[model samples]
Target chain A: MKEIWTITRRELQAYFDSLMAYILLILFLGFSGFFTWIYGSDIFFVKQANLQVFFSIAYWTLFFFIPALTMRLLSEENRSGTIELLLTKPISEWQVIVAKFLAALLLIVAALALTTPYYITVSSLGNIDNGAVFSGYLALILVSGMYIAIGLFTSSITNNQIVAYLLALSIGIFFQIIFQMLSSNLTGIAGGVTDYLSINSHFESMTRGVIDSRDLIYFLSVIVLGLVFSESMLMKKRSV
Target chain B: MDIVIENMTKTYGRQKAVDNISLQVKTGEILGFLGPNGAGKTTTMKAITSFLIPDSGKIFIGNISVNDNPQEAKKNIGYLPENNPLYEDMPVIDYLQFCARIEGIAKDKINDKVREVIQTCGISREKHKKISELSKGYKQRVGLAQALIHDPEVLILDEPTTGLDPNQIIEIRELIKKIGKEKTVILSSHILAEVEATCDRIVIIKKGKIVADGTVEELRSQAQGNETLKVTIEDGGLDEIFKALQLLNTVELVDFVDKSTQTFQVKSKPGQSSRRDVFNLCVEKGWTLTQLTFIETRLEDIFYELTLDN
Candidate 1:
């Protein structure tokens, strides 16, 4: 645990030192805040005190931002040959991967935390659905976790950051929209399977204050698979 | 701790990087690894550090098998890889602290340990600077400091002095020798003089296999079996002097090195010395013996002879 924290702390410091974290936070907040407060279909337009507007905007904002945050997590290390230096220490490969994962997740959480004024202001204006607000935040966190995993897996496979970003976006698109489209155009078991694979289906349910075990299982399983694939990629580098 | 490798072999695709090689480094010994490019020196060091697993065989660091428990085995090792890769964006102090923390140093002692290594590596002046802003020599020193922070039982340095100036190389070599007094040190370099100056034992490899392993003197004598002498005599015909030197029982072959100077080169039989016989012959012929110097076989010649043709 200490080893993981040590690496995670260094990674977070690097993110901030390079101004990557600040740029990401600013862009994320700018885009989400604009669409949720002043743009079309904002909270005032809906005439509801619920934070559905913010959650929906954040969902799309994080989808684009998470890949940018994670693109350099492993790819830069691989490119710089620092992976050898890190691995030779008294730490396992899993610890390194987990540390990077936590670093990116913590940065995303910080970005989400910065927008808490939105929640407070909405509650001040009218009676908000507290349960729905809590679940909406939970849904964003879960989706961010899944996308971060996929980004890390792509980063682990290649030493080029651009390649990692593109690959991650390609993989994320299927979960974000392709599955939803395929499910609507199909029928029977195939449609049900596509719907299950669509992250939007799971994310929308959680936003509506529904936290089913199936939804949790779906998100957690994707995160685990991504982490497992990243670990395997790291191990494969040793033999090659 | 002592490092032991038993018949380790690692291949990348169809090419063998390390081909069934075995070696041992006792504590307090500095073993210099010498080889050409792609000759498996780096591959062997990587295996010892648990960075690369061998296709067949095992490595043990103080009785702990690397394949079975790499984390435990790695605790005893401090490796400075070939290129000395580091996080260029990090400050020298912060990077050392991170290395110390990862080595499982006590939280309170991390600061002190990082300071000690910084002082030891002579990077105290640049500790606060970002690694990318430092010069190459300073960067190399930082890499050394990171490796020495935990003061592991074994130190593996691959081409540690490759890019340093002459003075910096000497300083680093002295530091390595000072540290090797208690730790098992394995350093690889193609610089023959550096190896001869620092290592207690030398191992030379070619094409993924060890071609020679011994002390400098041992390799010298092993490569040169017979004694040779360049003799300069006066008041005697060069051809006659050569004939007289060759006729001696100890001398195997003799040739006129310089006819004008009356210099003759003589080669003795295996394990034989022709100096006394040649001197006696000169006295018997009433020729003045001006110079008789032994020709020592150089390390370069030995390395070339061993590494050539394979």
Candidate 2:
């Protein structure tokens, strides 16, 4: 646990040092804040004190941002050959993968935290669904975690950061919208399976103040599977 | 701690990176690993550090089997891999601290450990600078510092001084020798002189297999099985000296080296010395023996002979 935290702290420091975290924060807050308050179907247009606009905007923003943040997590190490130095240390491959996941997740959480004033402003404006806002943030975090895991897996498979980013997006598209679109066009068991596989079904339910165990299971399983695959890819360096 | 490898083999596809190699490095020994490129020196070191798992066979670091408990075994090893890769964006101090933390040094002690390592590696003045900002010599120092942060019992450095100035190379070599006093150090280098200067034992590999293992003198004697001498006789004719030298019991063959200078090259019988015999023959014949130099086989010849293809 301490080893994971140490590595996570270094990775977080790297993000800030490289100015990636600050740029990501500004862009995320700018896009999400702009669309949620002043743009189409914004809060004033809806004439409601709810943050559904912010939550929806954040969902799409995070999907794009998380991969960018995670693209260099393992790829840079692989490119610079630092992975050899890192793996020779006392920590296991799983710990390194988990540490990278936590670092990106923490940065995402920081970005989400910066928008708390949105909640404050909405609550001050009128009656706000506090429970919905909390669940909405939870949904965004779960989605970010899932995408970060996929990004890490892609980074592990290649030493090129751009390749990692593109591969992650290609894989993430299915969970974000392709599966949902496929489900709508198909029928019967196939449609049902696609519907379950789509992230929107779970994310939308959570955004509406619902936290089912099944939804949590879906998000957690994807995160775990992605991390496991990344760890295996790292281990492949030894034998292959 | 002592390191023991038993018939370790690692293969990449059909090519065996390490082929049934076994070695033992005792505590307080500096074993120099010498080999041609792609001869499995790095692979063997990686296996010892628990970075590369062998296809078959076992490695034990003080009785801790690397395959069975790699994390435990890795704690006792400090490896400077080929090219000495590091986080170039991190400052020297921060990188060392990161290494110290990963090494599980206590929080309060981390700073002290980093400082000590920086001092030991002679990078104290540039500790605040980013690794990428440092020169190649300083960068190499940072690599050594991170490895020595935990003061592990075993140190595996692959080509530790590849791109350094001569002064820096000597400094690094001296530092390694100082550290090897209480630790098992395995350093790989293509520079024969550096290995001869620092290492206690040398292991030369070819085609993923160990071909030679011993001290400098041992390898020299092994290759220098027959004694050779270059003798210059002042008074006698070259042919007469050659024939007279050949008549000595210990002399195997004699050939004129330079007829104008009356110099002859003499080869002694296996495991025999002809210097004394040649001197007595010159004395009896009243011929002046101006120069009689023993020709020793060099390490380069031995390495070339062992590593070159048959």
Index of the highest-TM-score prediction: 2
What local lDDT score does residue B130 receive in model 1, on the 0 to 100 scale?
96
Point out where model 2 deviates above 4 Å.
B256-262, B284-286
Q: Give the C-alpha lDDT of model 2.
A: 0.94
DockQ (Cα-based) for each candidate: 0.84, 0.89
Number of the predicted model whose DockQ against the real structure is largest: 2
Model 2, B1-310: lDDT tens per residue?
9989999988888998889999999999999999999999999998888888888999999989999999999999999999989999999999999999999999999988988998899998898999999999999999999999998999999999999999999999999999999999999999999999999999999989999999999999998899999999988776777788889999998988888989888999998899999999999999998999999898899999999999
Q: Candidate 1 lDDT, tens digit per residue, A148-181?
A: 9999999999999999999999999999999999
Q: Which has the greatest lDDT?
A: 2
Evaluate residue B84 in candidate 2 and report its C-alpha lDDT on the 0 to 100 scale.
89
Q: State the TM-score for model 2.
A: 0.97
Q: Write the per-residue lDDT of candidate 1 for residues B1-310, one digit (tens) a residue.
A: 8899999999999999999898888999999998888999999999998888889999999899999999999999999998889999999999999999999999999999998998899998898999999988888999899899898999999999988999999999999999999999999998999999999999999888989999998998999999989999999877787777878999898877888888878899999999999889988999999999999998888888988874
Error of 1 at B48 (Å): 0.9
**Candidate 2's error at A197, in angstroms?**
1.1
